[model samples]
Target: MAEITVDLIKELRERTGIGMGDCKKALVAAGGDIETAITNLRKAGMASAVKKEGRATNEGQIGFFEAKDCIALVEVNAETDFVVKNDRFQQFLTHVAEQAADTKPESLEAFLKQSYAKEKGMTVDEYRASIVQTIGENIQVKRLSIFPKKANHSYGIYTHLGGKICVVVDLEGASDEEKLAKDIAMHVAAASPLYVNAEQVPESVIEHEKEIVKSQIAGKPENVKDKIISGKIQAYCKENCLVEQPYIRDDKLTVAQFVAAKGKEEGKNLKVVSFIRWDVGQ
Candidate 1:
């Protein structure tokens, strides 16, 4: 019979997040076999699985993968910052991103149901469950996206604060224009624009802002009130629209103007097609 050492008990406790005494007893019951002990703990529902499920997962790292004409971004979340730094969690996130890149699933539900190709006969959700059992935290795949290059298009990505924020941009331009795309992505990270252009701003949003601005200036003359509302709407668009916002690098120019100037310099018809930004837990 194998002797159950303290080190074995400690390892089990770390993996399962169970109490010290329970880990020791489980190890003893399994004759010091770590794998069997883990099984017993899980079967008996003494593992950290159920208790951790209801906890909010506000801490996580963004996983990313890029290939020729394709890119994927995934946000996998856990309950604590400590788990965010765990190597197993990081590895799992990387695998999730890679799977997104390969499969291009349309939605989060579909992505989880897809088989985890690296592991034999395991769905992504199953893999996620395995990770929860190992790390003893509520693990979730929050969101993911795949950006595949369209005809005559380019892509760029930027990850900030060690994946707390990520930006992906798609542009219609020459192949050598990836640097411009990357610069735009960085600007998106800083500016946090909600729409690509003034035209993309919804009519309802504009109406809502106008109502707020009108009420604030209602004491003024009727003619002046209209002008003030118009000005406020323009300012709102400038602040909220990506193309209308002032360039982060050069306040003298809007993002649209910056792209146009760069395009002229490179003799290309460059334009921003679309963009997506993700901030963890937002």
Candidate 2:
């Protein structure tokens, strides 16, 4: 039997775009013959996924999974909307989300290398490769997020438009907890606010908005300009900050004001601790 060196595995993986583990297995099975290994990978349908890796993946679905103390969000992308509806694709998303919910890996790279939750012996990357083979389309797990609940916080998630947009909100203390958290998630899905609060807005973004506002009022005096710019900045913050934005359910009250009112009534802290919004392909 020929020795299957690391060089052989590397070459096979480069040629086939199959995972390192599968490439090594193919090489060993083929007695270290690169051509034979390639043939074996092709026969197993694993090689097709590599070729399709460059295809544009603008359509897909967002999956949510929650356990007793952890919540996860996963976005998997495919080349077309038709594939999004495929049971295989949906199953793959579920598997990925479950893995995310279970492991809570710090990064996507780590998640890819972590052991798959449902498939006992394979890594997530390997499982994804198998699905790519089965689906006959390039499938990419674009992002995975895991948020473990804090002792003082409760979480809520909302998916709208069949997973086109998903929102996850973390709130301080559990006061009117379920309804408040859910309504906040719904507001995030609809309004698409960019930051949790004014503090989260970047200084560079504020400066950019200031420049645009200044340009719009080019002829104004310096003092008047300063006042106008300050007001514009406040308005911008209100528009972009989740807590400051007018609540979708009732525009008369800002989200922060609504939460504060509810908190006072319920006798608990109700601050928006943090949130994440995922819009497919964005």
The candidate that achieves the highest TM-score relative to the unseen native structure: 2
Which 10 consecutive residues of model 2 have the lowest summed lDDT? 173-182
Q: Give the alpha carbon lDDT tens digit for every residue of 1-282 in model 1.
A: 478888888899888876677689888899889999999878765575645766899899888898775799899999998999999898899888988988889999899888898887777876787788778889989988888878778787889998999998888877777788999999999999999998899899999999999879978999999999999999998999999989999999998899989999978888897999999997
The runs of at least 3 residues in candidate 2 whose Cα sits more than 4 Å from the true structure, single-residue gaps closed, are 1-14, 19-25
* lDDT, residue 157, candidate 1: 86
TM-score of every candidate = 0.82, 0.91
- What is the lDDT, from 0 to 100, of the residue 202 in candidate 1? 88
Query: lDDT by residue for model 2 over 11-87, one digit each (tens)?
Result: 88888877788788888889888999898778766788788888899999999998877899999999999999999
lDDT comparing candidate 1 with the true structure: 0.87
Model 1 C-alpha RMSD to native: 8.5
lDDT of each: 0.87, 0.87
